[model samples]
Each structure stands twice: as C-alpha cells, then as structure tokens.
Target: MDARTQWDAGRSEEWADVTPDAARRLLTAAVQAFAERGYHATTTRDIAGRAGMSPAALYIHYRTKEELLYRISGIGHRLALGIVSRARDGGGDPAGRLSAAVQDFVRWHAEHHTTARVVQYELGALGEEHHAEIVALRRETDAAVRSIVEDGVAAGEFDVPDVRGTTRAVLSLCIDVARWFREDGKHTPGEVGELYADLALRMVGYAHK
Candidate 1:
C-alpha cells in the first residue's frame, strides 16, 4: 500500500498507548507543527489551537512544550523498538529475520513519515535527559538489527565483515525513508519495504533466494 494508506492502516496500533482524547489531539497537532516548522519554531499555543483547545489546556497535561515533544519522541522510539523486536523475535534464520526486520523498519518509517520525521530528524529540541532516553531506546533498536547480522555471520549465512557498521547502514537506510518518501512517489510502503529487504539481505552477503 502507499505510505498514506499504510499510515492510516497502522496509525491506531502505533499510537494507542496515548490516553485521553485531549492529549491525543494535542500530540497530533504537535506532530504536524513540529514536522512543518521544527520543534523550536512551534509554540504550545499553535499546538493547542490546532488541537481545538485553549492554550492553558496544553499545560494541564504537559508541563512545557518540551514535555510535549518528550512524550511524542518517547512513544515514537518505543514503537520503533517494538517493530524491530517483533521482527527479531519472529522465527527465521539470519537471512529471513534480517529481511523481515528491514521490511518492517522501512515500512514504519514510510507510513509514519510525519511523526517519524520529528522522531528521527527533530530530536535535538528535546531536553538532555529526554534525548538521552530516546537514544537508549534507539540503541536497543540498533542491537536488534545487529544481532540478526551477528547471527548470520556466525552461521556462515552471510559474509558481512563489519557487523556493527553494516547494521548501522541497514538502519540508516531505512530511517532515511522519512526524509524523501511521498505518497505520490513511484513506490508504495510495501514495495519500498520489499526493495529494502532485498538490499538489506544483499548488504549482509545473503544471496537472493
């Protein structure tokens, strides 16, 4: 499916943890504002206005605008980690697991481009502690991919010489989808996922089946 379709299909699944209707609206608005104007440029009033709530209503749930960003980034990172974790935990040899991980990871980046863009690109706006927490979550995600590559290397299923660097490349490639993907683009999320799965497998020297 196209990124838009994919996003709509999976939106609730990714964001279901966020509670209360007002908080959800505020978060939704913050995502748009942050994606369009960057975190530093977006104000709580703008977010509240877009959410159809008064400015003071924003502080009822969040202490500051940074807190709003912290909540969004936290949820986004958790969702990313969950995606990789499920793909890793699902049964497969190294090659199979790697393909599934890459496909799912890439598809999430494409389908959730708006929030993903803020999560991947606009994190610098977060407080130091918040940013550090997100970084820790991201490290777990890296380990998920790296572990698959490591398993493949050990089993002689792949020929990657630099496991750590190769793993980083696989994730970096997937994360870049947020930067350039458009619904009007030639490929849909599923198609892009398939392509990335192949590329990720090739990266680890797993010959196409």
Candidate 2:
C-alpha cells in the first residue's frame, strides 16, 4: 500500500478532541461493525464488543446507535469536502485542478471504502436532521466540482455539454469507487487516482481539444 493510499482510519486528534477516547473508540468500532454487518443489522453489543467495552458502556458516550452513525457520517462528509476544497483551490489551472480533485476524491473513496460506503450510501439511515446536515455537506462538494468545470469552460479548456450533469457524473464515478474497489484488486489507490484523473480530463474534452 502506497502511503498515499492509506485508509484514513479516522484517527485524527480533531475528531478525538471533540469526542472522548471511549466514545471515539465506539465510533471507530461502529464504522467497522456497520461496514461489516450494516447499520440495521449491527447491534450495540457488537459495537461495544468490538470496542472492548460492555454493552451498557456505550450509553455513557452515545444515546443511541444512530447517534454513532451521525457522527461518523458527519466526519466522513467533512473529510470529503476538505480534500476536494484543497484540490480545487490549491495551485493549478482549471484542468489541472479538476484532475487533482477527481484523482484524490476517487482515491479516498477507494482507500476508505468501509467508511465511505457508510457515508455515501447510508445517509438514509440517519435521522432527518442529521441527513439534512450531511446533504448540505454533499452540496458543498457538488458546488466545488461544478465550479471547476465552469472554470474549464470559461478558459476554453473544456467543451462540456452540461456543466451540472457533467459535474454529477464526475463525482458519481468517484464516489462509486467505494462500492467495488478491493484490496486484492488490480489497481492501487495511486493507480486509480491517476487513471481517474485522465478519465476526468477526457470526459471534459481534454483529448478532443
């Protein structure tokens, strides 16, 4: 595994700062359990056991299992936005920036498949308020991608037919990496990233130009 392809185990001190150590353990454990057994099928006992705590110990940190889902989902969304924002705004032309954005976004989804699966596909499992909040975060990603496409068009670097549709397609392709990517698969995250970046460029008529 290339260091760049490391699955972000969500071990950041930032998340740890807001969440107590035990609570954070539960969250990490929940991500794996939920990813393995799914949100509906996974029990609090499963989560607690995975965290090496009694079932009742879970309540000390979270009111319910859905609460755990919300926190993980929130963290996942922020991580997605943070990565794309950097790729979008950090040094590059429109095409260069969009390529970097697609590559990195796809890599993260593929590398962090378990967490990304829950985040991208399991939003419906959250409470109404939590779902809404996650949707807002998703919109930020959509906007960032769209803006890059717009910039490409404005600069005559891309020949897109529908900026909005194209942006959605680009992100959909990247997000779907979580669904099928496997560690035993042929491509590394870096390889997938490179391949997807080229595909993104081609999608906008980079080669056609």
Candidate 3:
C-alpha cells in the first residue's frame, strides 16, 4: 500500500472501547519502547509488556509495531500543524503569529519529549512506504514555516535574506529542545518557550525592543 493508504489503514483501528486513560497508557508504552529499543527492534510484545497488557490484548489494539510507530509519529506531526494553524487563525500580524508558533512549538516538544524523540529518531525505522508518508507530513510542516518567513520578509516585518535557511534554523532550534530540556532544569517550559521565541524573532530580524 502507499503511504497515505497505510496511514489511513493503521488509524482505522478501533479505539472506541479504549478509555482515554488506557489510550494514554498505550501511547506512553509505545513511545517508551520505540525510544528505548529503537523502532526496528521494538515489538508489539515489548510494548505490551511495558504497558502491562497481554500480547493478545496489544494485538487487539495494534496489529504491528509499524502501526504503533506511525500512530505516534502522526500525532506529533498533527500537533505541530495544529499549533501553526491555530496561530495563523488567531488573526495576528506576522511577528505575533511567529511568536505564537514558536511558543507552541517549544511547549509541545517540552511536554511531549518522548513522543518528540520517537518521532525524530525512529522515523527511519518505518517501512519504506510508510517513511514516505511521514516525510510528506514533515515537508508540509517545513513549507508552512517557510511560507511564514517569506510573508514576514515581504511585509517588511523581518529582514531575512534566506527564508528556507531561516525556517530550518527556527525548526531545528525548537526540535532540539526535546533532547536537553528537563522538568527540573533551570527553565520551565514557559521560560524556554519565551526564550526561544525571542531568539527566533531576533534571527528573523524582528526588533524585540
């Protein structure tokens, strides 16, 4: 099957009987297994064991490891896109939208560190066909940010010479925060989000004064 078909098929699994709390446990276990054992090495049994469910029970929810991985990855991409969409719909100027986007990006990654880690590190572990779907989602995210930067430059709200490069820099800055941010770290998620928003604004040549 093609990537979109594969993703759609995977998402069609029935979670109607699964309570919100149980669903969270399942996703949490999936993320931990993917992160600890790597996607290629993780199995449904591994996740089941981690979540204290039987292998048969796990199968009832997820037929394969790839499906679980796709679900986790898909959620991360959707979360990022949702944040950007909300910012754009907020009817703000370029700088306000950019600041909102940056804040949302940082906060999401900080709160969902394991999900972010699995999304970033285990993408290659997806089946070749499934990898394409994930890549497409990622590209859409890149394009959204690039378009934002281009709009900012055109509107004279920012002075970036390279929209693509600036977009990559801004995204990388947010994505990498998951690698080092800790709940007990010197900065809380809100603090880190504001700091990164400031840095991203400066990078795009927005005057913060």
Candidate 4:
C-alpha cells in the first residue's frame, strides 16, 4: 500500500491494486520481459505468454506494450518520489535527513532492481506524452533532493558549493544501483543502502559526530 511496502514487495506484488488479477499478472510479466529483453525488443505476445494469457488478452487490459510500460514507469516513479519527498519533509538535522533519503532510495533500487531496471532504463521506449509525464515526476524528485541540500547548506550541516549538481549526483548514485545490483551479490540491499548513505554524507562534507 505504502511506498515502503511496495518497495519491499518485489516486482509483481507491488501491483496489488491493479484489478482483475489478470492485469497484475500482465504487469508482472511485462516487467520481467522488459528488464530481460528491453522494451523495444519485447513483444506483446512475449508479455502475454509470460503472463499465461493470450496475445488478445493483453489488449483487454492494456492498449499496447507502451501503455504497459507507461503504467509501470508511473507506478515506480511515484513510489520513488514518495521516498525522497518523505525524507525531505521529515523533521531532522539536514545530515540525518539526507542520509535517510539516500539510504531508503538506494535500498529501493537494490531491492527491486529487476522492475527498477525496466522502469528506469526503458524511458526512451515510452511515447511522447508518457515520456513527458515521467520526466515531470523526475523533476519533482530532483527538487526534493535539492531542497534537502539547500537545507543542509543553510543549517551549516553540509558544505555543498553547487547544490543542484550535488543533488543530481546524489540521485544518480542511488538510481544507478538498479543498473548493477544483483540478488546474489556480496552485499544485501540493506548493506548497499547503508554504504550509499554514508557516501552521500561524505559527498556533502557532513561531519559525523
């Protein structure tokens, strides 16, 4: 239901709200298909087959493969926005807030790397309108991180000379985790999250007490 729950729920279970169970299965299939084969390379039949449904059944739930991608992107980005925004709005020392933000953000990327890989890397496959909508959500994510950096600078908790650039770097670092993280990796998602959080603090020149 909440962003944290969705993040911890793996790829398919995050679609709990998607009606008809069949639709959810399609989404789950789409995520897997796209992540493995890429949105452009993946076919409607491929998605349908993975979901155990016929090709026509995919149209009953989603108009096109792009639409399915848009839905996945929208859901994933909204959850990501919630994570960063909550950390920004949470009342705490700027250092603490920034660390929390990066921790949770990185954890989500690692925990759901499969779906995340599709949601993040498949942006170029979306239609024009869908692309614009997802971009708008991304800008909000940028703003949320920037605000945290601004707060840190204001409170003398960090020494970031270029708040905007540093915000992008922080977000890029967290988001890129989805690109390389593996379930069988040396570190767990929580360990990766903690490492990234500490690295983010150092990036801002936060002096740990």
Candidate 1 lDDT over residue span 1-209, tens digit each: 64566578786666676779888889989999999999989999999999999999989988899998899899999888988998889887989898999998888888888889999988888889998999999999999889889988888889998899999999999999999998788998889999999999998998558
Q: Rate the local accuracy (lDDT) of all candidates.
A: 0.89, 0.86, 0.78, 0.90
- Whose lDDT is higher: candidate 1's or candidate 4's? 4
Q: Order the candidates by lDDT, highest first — what do you get?
A: 4, 1, 2, 3
Model 2: ten consecutive residues of lowest lDDT: 5-14
Model 4 agreement with the true structure over 40-72: per-residue lDDT tens digits: 899999999999999998999999999999999
User: Across residues 7-117, which tens digit of lDDT does each residue of candidate 3 receive?
Assistant: 334333322334665555677788888877788787788888888888888777777888888888877787787787777667667888888889988877776666688
Residue 90 alpha-carbon offset, candidate 4, angstroms? 1.3
Per-residue accuracy of model 2 over 1-209 as CA lDDT, tens digit each: 45433554433432655567899889889989989888999999999999999989999998999999999999889989988999879877898899899988987888788888988777889999998999999999999888999988999989899899989999999999999998788888778999898898988887443
Task: Return the lDDT, model 3, position 176.
Answer: 95
lDDT of 3 at 154: 85
Cα lDDT, model 1, residue 14: 65
TM-score of each: 0.96, 0.92, 0.86, 0.94
Native-to-model Cα distance after best TM-score fit, residue 8 in candidate 1, in Å:
1.7
lDDT for residue 96 in candidate 2, whole number 0-100: 88
| True-structure lDDT of candidate 2 | 0.86
